[model samples]
Target: MRRVVFLVQPQVYLLDLAGPAEVFHTARDFGLPYELSYVADEPEIITAELLPVRCATTWPALGANDIIIVPGKQCATLEDVNPSERALSMLRAHHRQGGMVVSVCAATEALGRAGLLDGRRCATHHQLQDELAARYPAAEVVRDVLYTVDGNLATSAGIASGIDLTLHLIATWHGPTTAGRIARALVVYARRNGSDEQVSALLRHRSHLSDLVHRLQDVIDERYTEPLRLAELSRKFGCSERTITRRFRDATGLTPLRYQQALRLERAEHLIASGTTVEAAARAVGFSDSRTLRALRAAGRTAAAVAS
Candidate 1:
């Protein structure tokens, strides 16, 4: 099995470590060929959360298919982090041997110290964008992006962007379908492109978990182009229309019809982004009337404006 090894650094932020770890763990739970492990330079490491982290001290033999992730730590400045040179060297050596290297948030500093980010496009937390560029003149720092992929190196933005970056990696290694499934299971809105900052309405509307809600989401996700009425959904899973409606709303804060419409609208947006006309985009996502599509577009704009 290909290993997904996390390199734990001292004074690390817990979420930066846990987010990507849970992502890979979910992939493994889905029966993917991934062995998740953690390595540390010392027997125990201190976290900014005040919780101590301890993992394997001995480094495992890595292969080309293996991935090594360096999660960002909590600090006001990069100087506050104290990762050992040996750990940074391990990342450089792994990359040199054709292995993939990933960095989360401030973890890009570790990559910078190892000379891995030099002359490569990378991303980090927005707060540290200028500092990253100044510290590593050769590294091209991409701002306002969840993550960036430059050759074997990948870097993600702060905090929650780690999940989006890991999902992208999953789609890269597995496929878009698998990544979508994982994201749905995790109830996360997957970003098709890091440059797009908006999350899909379907994902944002998810409030809780329910088996019926998940089943309905899977069907709508897999076949959003087809006609999927509420009655059809009710019949497919042997649940009455009333039960499905109430339960779905209780779990996801939206009706089944609205959820399906959200999927169609999200696809329409993507189609337009890829050079399709507004009418063509609407038709491409199962809308027969451009009038309703126009209204949906207007409503979307209104919602975004309200949020902004």
Candidate 2:
């Protein structure tokens, strides 16, 4: 069985680590042959969000694993958990021998600190974007997307984006049919393309902007599955149609309809990955009909397969 060794550290966010653990372990839930284990610099009890989790091996004691996953923590201080020279050297040695390293959220900082990100494009928690940029000038800090995969190195933005990254990894390794099954078991959107930005106007439209825009985004996100219209949405917000349209577009970079289309496509991708029929996914995302959805789905499938 292939082994994925999760390198846990103090202050590791439980979700960032656990999400992939569950995804990889439950591959049996979809009939894959792989195993996941937790390791660290020492056999330590780790805490995240004040929760406790245990590790079984120290980093140096770890053997050749198929993959190593490093997750993020809440610590804003880089100096605290940045990889030590020893850890950095070990990671470089593993990658030099063709091992895969997966870093989620701010854990990419450790990779950057090790000089592994110097010429690569990577993502992290949006809050730490500037710090990563200043710290690793040779690293191409990709601020736009949810995740990035350059060669054997894969990185993702904070929290939930990690799930998307893992799903993408599974999709790449096990084929879309298997990946969709795992995603369905997880009750998550199956596949947010690595190219998808974590802070797209659509995502930010729902949360990261001014209070009013944020509220509007919340409504759109919740009701995106239902039929939505500019006039109705404008009236609900107590604003004119034009004002709502302008503001929505400004906040999310896509008009309300286009934004909904993107959301539906995102959701459709999830459904399709979960083994749903393309027609069903299209209707679920509120497509006017199935033809366009099929066409779009075909185009996307072609693109992803080619990318792989």
Candidate 3:
């Protein structure tokens, strides 16, 4: 059986712990064998957001070839949480030894504190956007997105976003069709994509950084409605065009043009899902016309169909 360990902590959000657990437990229906367990730094009764639950064993006692999930806690102060020390250590060690480590919401901060997020791209609750960015300057913090998977580390935003992240894992492990079936059985309309904003309107908070790169991101964020050109941005920054291109590519994987298009498409998708007319979405995202929009939509549909 594939093993899944939930490293439960004090004040852990019940849904964050349960949502992914339900997905892994239901793996049998998708023809995957899974053994799920709840673990902590010590084997004892612990109180979560809900009624007190007993942790069956210490993390060290768990076996291998499985997954470990760190659920979000209500508290933001991770440095003072002693319950996280052993659990975090185990999670890092497990991940280093090739185990999948999942962190939801504020729990992503624990992974950062444990040094697991160094040089990794991740997402977390937008409320902690500044905290995570300032705390781990080396880590790339993506706000608004539902989840991000950097190699073995998987992270999600706050609260119900855990459901989306968990269902994504199911799709990765089994297949999209199986995951869709499970979502239907569970009565969820669809699994939120990784790019979906889990913390809508909460990403206004940003880290205090002198990096001109942030200004670049801001320009893209605001001027997504306007035409974006790498040469124009380079001229604006007053540096060599090569320096601008290098810094922008280093900070974000895409060229400035591609990144702006991605943002526009993301907004377009949000409109489509929210009952907005396709034409409205096209105009809102600054597409030249509906011909390009329809083509993009068709391409996206084909990609999703292929993935499924």
TM-score of each: 0.72, 0.63, 0.62
Query: What's the count of clashing pairs in each model shown?
Result: 0, 6, 0
lDDT of 3 at 24: 72
Candidate 2: 10-residue stretch with minimal lDDT: 199-208
Of candidates 3 and 2, the better by lDDT: 2
What lDDT would candidate 2 get against the real structure?
0.74
Best by TM-score: 1
lDDT per residue as tens, model 2, 15-98:
898888888887866667677777776666456777767777555333444788888877865556565576677678777767
Candidate 1 ranges with C-alpha deviation above 4 Å: 189-193, 200-214, 222-308
lDDT of 1 by residue, 32-116 (tens): 9999888998889888888998889988999988999999998898776567878888888999998999999999988888889
Show the colliding residue pairs in model 3: none
Model 2's TM-score against the true structure: 0.63
- Overall local distance difference test of candidate 3: 0.73
Q: On residues 53-96, what C-alpha lDDT tens digit does candidate 3 reach at each position?
A: 67866553444467888888777465533444666678778888
The prediction achieving the highest lDDT against the true structure is 1
Assess candidate 1 and give its TM-score to the true structure: 0.72
- In order of lDDT, best first, we have 1, 2, 3
Worst 10 residues of 3 by lDDT: 199-208
